[model samples]
Target: MSASVPRLLVVGGNGFLGSAICRLAVGKGWDVSSMSSSGKPYATPAGHTPAWAPRVKWHAASAFSPDSYSTLIGESTAVVHTLGILLEDVGYKQSVKSGDVFGLVKSFASSLSGGDGNPLKSEEERKRGYEGMNKDSALTVLDTLISTTPPTSTQTRPFVYISAADAFRPVVPRRYIETKRQAEIEIMRKCDEHPEAGVRPTFIRPGLMYHPHIRPLTTLPAFLVDLSAKLSTASGLPNPFASKSPLHGALESLRTYPLHVDHVAAAVLKCIEEGRGGVVEVPEMRDWAGLGSKKKAEVGLQGQ
Candidate 1:
C-alpha cells in the first residue's frame, strides 16, 4: 500500500478482462493507463467512453514491439498483463506458412535436443506446430518485460497476470497451458533476478466469467452450459443441473444468477489492496456470497 496514488499500466486494456480491470482500478482512485494496438479511446456498448477513460491516458502499442511498451512499464507502479489469444490471425497464419515456422521449430528443437535433431525434424513439426504462435508470443512478451524493465525497481512494482483456471490443470491443452506456464517461469525468474527491484509477480486465474452487459454469443461457456441442461432435461434424464460446479451452474442460471460485473471488479480491487501476490484461483467476490450466507445464518440464529 503506497501512500501516493498508484499508477497502473494495463496491457490490452480494450479487451473484456482488461477493460473490467481498468474500470475497477479507476474506481479505487488509482491512476490508470491503458495500451492497445488501436490507440483509440475505449468505448463501452452504450456508445460512450467510460468516465474513467477521460482520467486515464491511452497508449498505442504492439506486443511484438518491446520498445513500444518499455517506457510505460518503467513509469508505472504496477503492470497487469491481460493479453492472450486463442487463435492466430490470418496474417500470423500466413507468416507461419512461410519460412518462419520452420525457423522457429528448429530453434525450439535445438534448445531441447542439444542441436542434434535426433528425434527428426518431421517429428518436431508434428509436436510443436499447434503451439508455435502462442508459445512465441508468450515468450516474446516475457523476454521484453524482463529485459526492458529496470531491475532495481521491480520488487516494489507488482506484475499481475490474469490467467484461466484450466491453466493449472493437466487436462488443458499444451498449446494453451504451455504459454501460461512459460510466462509464469519468466515472472519468477525476473523476481529472482531482481530481489532489490522489489517487483512482486502474481497470477489470478478466474473461472468462466459472465457479465450481463457482455454479449451472450461472446460467452461460449455460459451458452454451452445452458444448452446442455436444456437438452438433458428434455430427454427426461435425471436433472443434470446440480451436477455441475457452482460457478458453471450459476453462469447457466443467468436470469437468476447474482454474480455482477461490479462484483468481479471488486475482487480484482481486493487482490491489489491486500497485496496477496500469488496464484489466486477462483477469486470470486466473497462479499456477494457472504450476503447470502448471512441471510441464512440469521434465520438459523433466530430459530436457535
Candidate 2:
C-alpha cells in the first residue's frame, strides 16, 4: 500500500459488516489493519470472492481493553467500531466458537460491571452485557485512540460506530436499543466537549441487513417485516427475530428497514472517506453506500 494512503483500523473486522468494509477499503487502496480477539480476517480464493485478505493486516485484541491494540492504533487515520449484539446467548457463543472475536471483550467488561464472573444468566446480567459491550466499548476505543494516538494533523481522526436502527424495534429487548443510544449519547458528548481530542465520532445506525442472494427473494416478506418493525417501536413487542432457523432468520432479516449487508459496509467507508461525523440514519445509509441518485430516490420512497 502507498504511504500516502490512509490507514484504517476496524474492530470486529471479522464479522459480517466489518469484513465488507475491509474488502472495500482494500479496493480503495487504503492501508487497512483489522483488530479482533480472533486475529483472523475472512479469506477465499481470489477468483471465488473479492481478494481483500492479501491487503489487510490483522491483529488479535479485545475491543474492551485498549491496551490490547493501543500501540497499533496510533498510526491509523480512522477506526470503525462495529461492535454490538442483537441479543445475548447461544448464537453469541457460536460466534465465539467460530473465532469471531465479536463481543468477547465487551462480555468481560459486562461481567465486571455486574460484579459477577459468571456468564450472563439474568436480566441484570444481560443489561450489564449491553451496557459494557454496546455502550462503554465505543467510548473505550475512542478514549484509547485520543489518549494514545494523537492525530498526524489538525484534522480530526474519524471513528465510525455501528449502532442499530432497530433500537426501537418492538420484538427486541429495550436494553439493546437503550444501551446503543447511551453509547451514541456519551460518544457525541465527548466529541462535542473535546474538539482537540483528535477524534470525530460518527454513529451509523443500520437497518436489518441481509446478503443480496436472499434479499431479492424476500421482497414481500421484507415489506411485512418493515410494517411489523414500525409497529414494534410503539407496541414494544418482544423481538423474536433472532431465530436460529435459517429460513426464519433469513426472512426476519427483512424487517426493520432492511439494507443489504454490502450497503451497510459501504456506508462506513464513505463516512471515513468524506470525513463526515454524527448520526447516519437509514435514509442516509444508501446514499453513503453509493447507491447513486436513482437508487437513492427509490430508497427515499421506502421512507427508511
Candidate 3:
C-alpha cells in the first residue's frame, strides 16, 4: 500500500494529538486523511475553521466499522490509531470540555480497582473501559488493515499505535496501562503471525501529552506534574504533595516528564518514515524530534 506521494491515514484525527499529527503531517507534505466519529475538527472559539482543515480529507466513521472507511485506510502507505480512553465514567471530550480537572482525577482514583468489569467482555463493547478502547479498538482496526489487502510479504507497510508511557504511580487504573500493553502485544503478535501481511507494527508510547492551543487546561497541571516527576527521577523522592492529596500526587508522577503533543506527533511521523516495528519510549520520542523533554516540559509549563 506504499505510495509515491506518501499518503497517511490517521484514525481519530479530530482529536488533540490526532489534530497535531494531521497538521504537522500536512505541513511536511504528506497526503493526509483523517477519520473521526465527528468527521471534522472542533471549531475555534470564534466559530471559524482552521486554514489547515482544508488540506485533510475528513471522514466520519468508526474504526470498528472499517467497511465505511477502508478505501481511505487502504490508500495510505502508513496508518495511525490514536483513539483511546483514560477513564470509564466520562468521555474524553466531555472531561476536557467541562473543565473539571479535579473531578476527572477523582474519577480515575475511583476506578483504580478495575471492579467495573472486564472492558474486553465483547467486541461490541468497545467503549466500556480501558480494554475496549485502548486494546480492542486497535486490534479491530489492524484486522481491517490486514483483511483489506492481500499480503505481500515484501511490501512492508507500517502501522503505528499510540500507546501510553504508563502511570509511574497508581493514579490511573491499572487497566489503563495494562490495556495499552495488551494492544502492543496483540499488535506485534498479529503482525508477526502474518508476516506475509506486510504490516510492520510500531508502538509510540507518549506520556502526559499537553498542548497550549488545543487543550490549555492540561498545561498548568503538566507544569506541576513535570516538577514532581523530575524530583522523583533525580532523588527518588516520593510525591511531596502526597500528604495533602495522595491521588493527585500520584497523577503528577504519572510520567517522569510531560510531552508537548506536537513533539509526539512529530515522533509518530518519524516512526512512520522509518517503517520499523518496535516500542519507542518517551525519551526516544523527544530525541527523534530533536527536542529534549525538559525543554518541551518548560514550554508546556509556560503554556507557549
User: By summed lDDT, which 10 consecutive residues of candidate 1 come out lowest?
Assistant: 166-175
lDDT (Cα, tens digit) per residue for candidate 3, span 1-304: 3546678889888877888889998998899998888797645534568898889998898876778887777777788999988776654455665566877666666666556566346656545567777888789889888876743446777899999875534656556777888899999999888877788899988778887656777888789878876666677554555433536436545445788998899888888877657988877876766755433344456644
lDDT of 2 by residue, 148-209 (tens): 64655565788889998743333344566678888889888887787777788888987666
Question: How many residue pairs collide in each prediction?
Answer: 9, 4, 0
Q: Report how far residue 187 has shifted in candidate 3, in Å.
A: 0.6
Model 2, CA-based lDDT: 0.69
Candidate 1: C-alpha RMSD after superposition: 10.3
Which has the better TM-score: candidate 1, or candidate 3?
A: 3
RMSD of 3: 7.0
Q: What order do you get sorting by TM-score, best first?
A: 3, 2, 1
Give the top-scoring candidate (lDDT): 3
- Point out the worst 10-residue segment of candidate 2 by lDDT: 212-221
Query: What TM value does model 2 have?
Result: 0.70
Q: What shift in Å separates residue 236 of candidate 3 from its native position after superposition?
A: 6.9
Q: Which prediction has the highest TM-score against the true structure?
A: 3
- TM-score for each candidate, following the candidate numbering: 0.63, 0.70, 0.82
The residue ranges of model 3 lying beyond 4 angstroms of the native Cα positions read: 1-3, 45-47, 102-106, 109-114, 118-126, 150-153, 236-255, 293-304
